[model samples]
Every structure is written in C-alpha cells, then in structure tokens.
Target chain A: MRPGISKILAACAAWGDKTAFLDCSGASLSFAQLHELSLRLGTAFRHMLKGATGRPIAVVADRSVRCIPVLLGAALSGSFYVPLDGSLPEARRRAMLAAIQPELVVGLAEGTSEAGFRYISVDELYGTLPDADELPPVDGDMPLYGIFTSGSTGFSKLVLKSYAALMSFIKAYIETFGFSERDVLGSQIPFSFDASTKDLYTPLACGASTLIIDKGYFAQPGRLAELLRDQRVTSIVWVPSALSMLSRFGVLGHISLPDLKRVLFVGEQMPVRQLNIWREALPDALFANLYGVSENAGNCLYHVVEKSYGEDERIPLGKPFPGTQVLLLDEAGAIIPPDQPDLQGELCIGGEILALSYYNDPEATASKFVPGPPGVGRIYHTGDLARYDEAGDLVFCSRRDHQIKLHGYRIELGDIECAALACPGVDAACCLFDPGKKKLTLCYAGASGEAALRTHLKGALPAYMAPGSLVRLEKMPLNANGKTDRVALARRYCGGGDVP
Target chain B: MIESNAMKEQIISILQDILPGEDVTESTTLADDGRIDSLAVVELVTEFSIAFDVEIPFSDLVNENFNSAEAMEAMILRLQQGT
Candidate 1:
C-alpha cells in the first residue's frame, strides 16, 4: 500500500479547492493551500536536512492551523513529527525532547516554545524554496509519528508508530464509518493525543473538512454547542470526558445540532449517565464507543450504541476493525477462549495495529510488545483487563496497575507522586482520583504550604495531570513496611468530601 | 445589595469552603487561569445562590462573570437587583 503522506497527496488531487480545515478563529485552509504549504515545508526540511532523512522533527503543538501542514510536511520530506502540548511544564517538555532528540524544533503558529532548542517558524518553512518538484520516496515501514504519553516514572513515554500501521487503521476507520466530502468533522481532541489523528486524517482520506473547535470552548459548553451548530458539523470523534462535560453542562437541548450525526468517543469509558444525556438529546445520532491506544493509530474496536441499556450498564468495547485481531490472554499467557464468558484476561492487540516500539525505551518495548499465541502476530499487552460479555463483546474491567483514566487522560499515580517528591519540602506524597467526583486530589506531607505545592505542580505537570485540589498534612500515614499508607490516606481525606 | 466588602468577604468565605487549600485572592482568575472547572463553578454557583438568595442563570456563567470575586459579586448584584 501507499505511505501515510500519500493520502494527503491524493486528497489534494481530488479535492484541491475544498476547504480541508477551518479553525475556530474563522481561518480556513483549502486542500490546495494545505498541499502547497506542505510541499513548501517539505522543501524547507530538505534544505535543513541537506541529505539526512528519517529523523524526528519536534513541533510544539499549540492550537493553530499551521500545525497540520507542519506535521504532514515533516512526513513528506521523509521524517516523522512529534507533536507536544505547548502548555506542558517546561521541565516535562524538556524531558520529552531529551528522549526524542528531534532533528529540528518548531512552533509553527506563535507556538509557545522553550529555550535550549533552536526553533524555526512556518514562515521559514515557506521560505525554504519556491517549490519542490518531488518528495522523497517513503515506505510503509517508515516511522510516521512518535507521540508521548504519561509514564509511571514521571518521565513521558514516546510511542513510535509506523506509517503502515497508521495507514491501515485510518483506511479501515474511514471505510467503516463512511466519512465523505459531505461530512464536516468537529475536531476537539488535541494533536498530542493519538486519537486526534482520526480527526486530522479522515478529511484527507475521504475529502471531508474538519472544523478546529476552540479548546477553550470545551469548558464553555454553550459556546461548544453554538460552534458545532454554526459550522454544520456532521461528526465528532472526541474523548468521552469532554462530551461528558458538555452533557453535564446541559447545552444539548438548548442548542440544535441537526447536522451532527456521528458521536464517536475513545480514551476512557464513556459514563453511561453522560452517554444517556447525549443519546436523549440527539435521538437520531449514531453513538459509537471506540477502543484503542497510542500504540495503534487511534482505535481498533468500534461498538455502535445501537441498543439501549440502563444508566448503570456498560457500553461494550465491541469487535475489532477489519484486519485487526484481539485476544484475551490469561496469567499463563494462553488465550482465553471466546466461550469462557465470565473470565477476565489482559487484552492483547495484534495484526497491523501494533506499533514499532517505544522510542528510547527498550525494556518497556520488550515487556509490552511480545509474540502472540500461535498464528497471531506479535502483540502489545495492553495493561487493561477485559472480559467477554454474553453479547460476545469485550467488556472492560479495571486496570491491572495504578494507572487511572481521568477526563480522557491516562495518568500514572506514581508519576504525580514522583513529581511531588522532587518538589522542595515534600517528604512523601500520594495522589488519588475520585472518578465519581471527577477530581484528582493530591495528598502530601511536607513543610511546603498548599500554594507552594500547587505552583510546583502547575510547573511540573500538565493541567490535567496536576491535581485540581490539594490536601497537605504534617506527616503521611505509614503502612507496615514503612511505605506511605494509601488506604489510611484515602479513608481520611478521600471519602467523597470536598477535599476528596 | 449589602456593603461591597461584606458581600465580597462572604463570597470569599464560601469559595474557600468549596475550594479548600486554594488561595482564593480578590483578583484570582477563576476560569481563565484554569483555577476553576465546571464542577467548581457549579458548586460555587450553588453556594452563591444559597447565600445571596439570587439565581445565577446559565447565561451569566461566562468567563468574564466568573473570572474574579468582584466579577462574581457584580453579577450577584445585578441578579439581586433584578437587572
């Protein structure tokens, strides 16, 4: 099959005059403009690389239209893009940069960037040359993009995905969903998140346009509803948490989103309570629960909410996409037969969905990516636990580890604790998430006051990773082995109170 | 409306109770600074409605009104005076 960038090339040929992207600020990029800019940036990268290719190019992913072209351009020139959230703590971004050691660093559209990395701009990319006659030949095996996710050790983990894997998933997703030139996808997911790729590339594959909804509009559900209606948005593939927030804000009934047809969600489990609200509001809309990770392009499992269920019932994780295989491996690494209904096993993903490896992390790559049972290919051991329901769909169970998914972000509790311990005057720390309250409460025993720790956390972790509220104690409760007693701490402070 | 300082003090006291361990200054940027989320906004609005006996409508829940204590108080005053 063709390489990942070829999809854009084909789109440029088919729908050059069509609007490919429309930013919330009323800025629009036609397919022709996107193609021309991508070519220019590719030529610029060629000049920068001189002869080098297959290098990592870091792009500070501030909310801007320039970011899309910059990413595709990097691939056009035979290099991969690493999209970073500009709002991340400098120290955290620095750690991520250190891991990738990107060939070039950039902030394409007034993108917020830090020092120590020689940065470039989109204008400079356009200035490279008038035009490049041809792009470098690329293979499906070539790295497409490497994305960083939260790590248990406080260091971000860069998961590198190949163009082949991305291409396969995108093709399957678009074909299955039947996205077309008539569809206007409302983009909400951040570029840093793997799922954002679905919103970015669906247009290229099917000649649709994506409305770059303002990130700030998420907190203001009324504005979000207004924008979706104004833009005539037909589809939305976003994290369930953001959808939950809008549902919680009660904006659906007030605003009419007649054109919004598809509501696809991934990242975390969509709360049935929140799902019901959306379902009730948009009675005719197709609501689907997508399941996958950064290891894949976006998702492999797609479950359409065709049937109604109680607010307490779960929406299944559904069957795999075309050409993808899913397995339930028991403790002995044997595949749990499909007929074994009530037994839970660790979910293993295989086929074209597997990523190349974790960038700069050999042990992590080795431990998670392993050979599958018998005819199945090498699989990625998703730390998530799953069970087969009577409907024959995979039902998600709890995670095997302490990693918790909050507001569509997968956070390792230890990462927060590690960052807290590094702060001045912090003796011991424990972070917990009350899913019901949707709050991250960090409890720390330290000489530093609440405000000081808050500042430190703000500068160290992303806003989602940072605890919304803090609980300070003179000393931490200890367990038998002299470890921080998380149970005692949870019992005292995290009992569903305001502090909790 | 009651005296400005007394009303502001009452708001601050309620905010502190809702968002403990946070330094709620007079000029604190609530929504803009990302200090307050939808949940916090809901809680604060509930408390303000109980204390001030004024219903803060959803339309008044924009960032400008919820940005600071003064902004919050101004909105409360408008709602109290039936503006």
Candidate 2:
C-alpha cells in the first residue's frame, strides 16, 4: 500500500465508530463505514483502471459527505483525483475538464451530463461492495490529486500533487490545530477551491465529523447561521466574505451556536472592521487568519487572534507554517535583508508544499516558479507585493498583475476588456475596481449609460463582473509604464473617498 | 384582497429595495431581458421567500418565472397557493 493511504486507513480503523461525515442533506457516515466503503470503492475503481496505474480520476461533486471517501478511495486504488466545481458555467467547466482529461468522472448528480467523458455516480459505486480482501495495493510517489489554478496568462493550469505532499500538508495542519476525533468541522468553501482541502481531508484523517453545507446556503447568510446551529459544528473554515455577510446582516449576533470553537478565514484580506464584529459575537472562538495560494497545496501562513487586540493594530499574517519557508525577494531576485521594514518585495514561498509545476504550461511554470539563490532551490513567485514590518509580520500589498479581487472573486482586467469588446456600443473599455463600494466601474470612450452598459454586460459577463457604475472617459489615462494608470482612474471616480 | 396592480407594485418595490442602485419597473425582465443577473435573482428570491413564505428551488431559477414584476408576483402567488 502507498504509505500515506495506509496511514489514513489505519487512522480510520483506530477511530472506528466515530462519525466521519455529516452531509447537510441529513446523511451521516462513521469512520468504520467510510473505511469499508472506501475499500469497496477502491476495488471497484481498480476494475475500471484498465491497466493505467497512477492515472488521475477527475471528480465533479458538490460539497457532500461522499467527496472525502471518494478521494481516499481513488488514492487507495493507486489513482489520483481532480475535483471540478459543477456549479460553474458549462463553458468554463468544459474548459477545466478538457485540460485534465481523466480516466473517469465520478459522483455526478442525476440528469446532469457532461459530454465526452465516462462517469459513475456515488450511488453506483456504493450500491454493491466488492470483496474487501481483493483491494488493490497503492505504491510509490504517485499523484494524489491535480488541483487547477487560474493561469497567469489566460488559461487554467493543473498542479499535480504527490501523495507525499498531501500527507505532509495534512500532518502540518493536524499538528497546528491540534485537531482530534471530537471536533465537528463546518466546510463552506466549494470542493474546487484549495481551502476545501483542509475542510474535506482533515476531519476524515482525524476521524472527526465534517458538515458539508450546500453552496446555495452561502448566498443566504441567515441560512448559514441556522446550519451552524443545527449541525453543532465545532469548527469552520470559510472565506472572509462569508463572515462579513454573516456579521453585516446580524446573523452572527442573532444565531445561538455554543459549539463553534475554531473560525478560520482566508481567500481575501480580513478587514479589522469585520474582525471586531466576529470577535464580539464569538467571544470564545479561536479566530485564525490563513494566507496562501493554491500553489502551496493549501495555507502556508496563519495568525491566531489575540484576546486583547489593540485598536490601532492591523491583524498580522503571522509566521509560515511548519515545513514552509517564506522569503521577501526584490524584482531582481535578491533576498531583502531581515528587519528592514521599508523593503517591499514579491513574496516568494519555498518548501515541501510547493507544487511541482503548472501542468502542460512550462512557459508559465518557468516565469513564476523560478530557481532561487544558489542553495534555496525553486520558489513560487506569489506575485503579491508584500513587505516585512518592523515586528517581522508580512504586510500584503497590491498584486503585480492588475488582477482585482472584488467580493473575494479574482477578476482579471483583461477579462473585463474582453467582455466589454463583445458589447455593441463599446469601442474600447477599461473597468476599474472602486474598493470603497466594492464596485466595478466601467469607463468607456463609447456611448452607453449606466443602464444600457449594465444590460449589455449582463449578457457578456457573470453577475459579479458586471459594472455597478459607468463613467464616460474621452481617453484612458496611461502612466509611464505604458499601462492604464488605474491610480489616476481611481482618483477621478473615487474623488478622495476612503478606500475599502 | 391584494389587488393585482398592488401586488405588482409591491414586488417591484421589493426588487428595488434588494437591488439598491437600479431603477426597476413593472416591465423589467429579471433574466434574458438583462435587467438582472443570477446574483440579483438570488437576492430577489431570498426576499420574496421571506416576505411571502415560499421555498424556491435553485433549479427553478429561470427567466420565465421572473421576466417582469407582474410575473414574479404571479409566481409568488402560485407558490403561496401550492403550499
């Protein structure tokens, strides 16, 4: 058996009848049940392997109790898993599926069909158990999963993670949190996001119960609060937007949840305004801010909130996780001297958790994942501009790319331009994010009002990308860098308002 | 009895409240007519569910049921009756 898979299966066995998963739809599975079912599913997948050992199996399941076992089942069967968010648009979903053409697509919902792929639903796999004695043995540094990240250029690239890396990340996470079998975890991120890795895997590894909430519930913060109360969830890992919405709508204040202990927020900056509300609401909870990208497997940095946070203090993204090394390097790739607070550089992460490379996109892999100084080996260029403060905490700055994150969704400026060019009235357009309102404002040289342009954009882009305000500009302002001066644009439209 | 015109006006008012910036009217189609996107529709549905006490399924979220303020009011009435 593969070393990681063997250890996880043994952990499941050791914790025997403990609850392993709680599907929000009212289904619960115990660790013993999960182990047996995983073995059966592994044997079933082995029969379908068609002699292609170590090949990845793509999974397109929503957040459910069945997702973890299916992942473990794939690992035990000597295959990897690639998760695709089924909620995405068909075109985007097809693009991702095509990039990582897998041996099988598992756990699709009824009447939902994607063309040009063979699939088996979870219902089919668990209907009958194969003889457990005949389960296949897993071996070697075979991949455990291939998680895709948005490419620096246009397309998305898959990052194949070895079983060793996955296990190492899981080990670090378990040790950091001191998680045990008694904890009940609440998962809010989609199965596709890297944040869900901890949500889905950590609980099963510790034989704890993971409560999978439906994505639709995320839009309604009230329902999310109700789910937390009803599920008796002891821990939660979610994006800051979810917490912000919860606090804004008073759901956190009104809800009565006595069991919640650990609250982990990531995927965006956690404003102190929002954190203050959370601190008051869940006075006993251990609130943690995690920082990382998909390239580092999962989180690489974490900061636990202090009991007595000063009013003037900005929350620091504390030191790196175990087995990870962080460095602040200038544009020339020289490491900045430690204790130099004024030195701002790109955040470069190096460690065991760094992804191997972008799948099939060597040019991009070379550009971002470059070799570090002589003895340091390869490091991931985070592209995030950051500087160490006098206190040794990393303070994040704007991205080198004009990628703007509004409401936790990453928006590339190029995507807005492409969408705008598709519109009828637009000759040329540039969209800028007003951080104050968390709104996208479209400044165009063409004839279109806020209404007409909004109507046009609704057809071209997703709801979030549609401009909230339209500003007409005779010509776009460009800086010395020959790029559109976004700072000038912000000054023009924002008009000295406080930036969000 | 809630008059048909009053129901439409009430629905439009609710939509206007939910989508703060827009100038929504009785003729505004929430979907393909492009007055609103999926996120706005979700917001409208949540408000409608709370105000009228009906559960709207995610799969049933389509342009046909919410083309106009009148259509949304009619859908809400239908849902209320079915319950």
Per-residue CA lDDT of candidate 2, range B15-82, in tens? 77655566668455555544554335545655665556677653345566666776777777777777
True contacts kept of 2: 0.00
Q: Which model scores highest in DockQ?
A: 1
Backbone clash total, candidate 2: 1
Model 2 C-alpha lDDT per residue in residues A52-92, reported as the tens digit of each score: 66677888877677777787788777788888876565787
Q: Determine which window of 10 residues in candidate 2 chain B has minimal summed lDDT.
A: B33-42
Write down the lDDT of every candidate, Cα atoms only: 0.78, 0.71
Chain B TM-score for candidate 2: 0.76
What DockQ does each prediction reach against the true complex? 0.18, 0.10
For candidate 2, the per-residue lDDT at A283 reads: 91
TM-scores of the candidates are: 0.80, 0.73
In model 1, what lDDT does residue A99 have? 76
- The alpha-carbon deviation from the true structure for residue B28 of candidate 1, after best TM-score superposition, in angstroms, is 7.9
Candidate 1, residues B25-44: lDDT per residue as tens digits? 66557778666655466556
Kindly list the per-residue Cα lDDT of model 1 for residues A147-207, writing each as its tens digit: 8764432345788888888878888998888889999999887788888898888888788
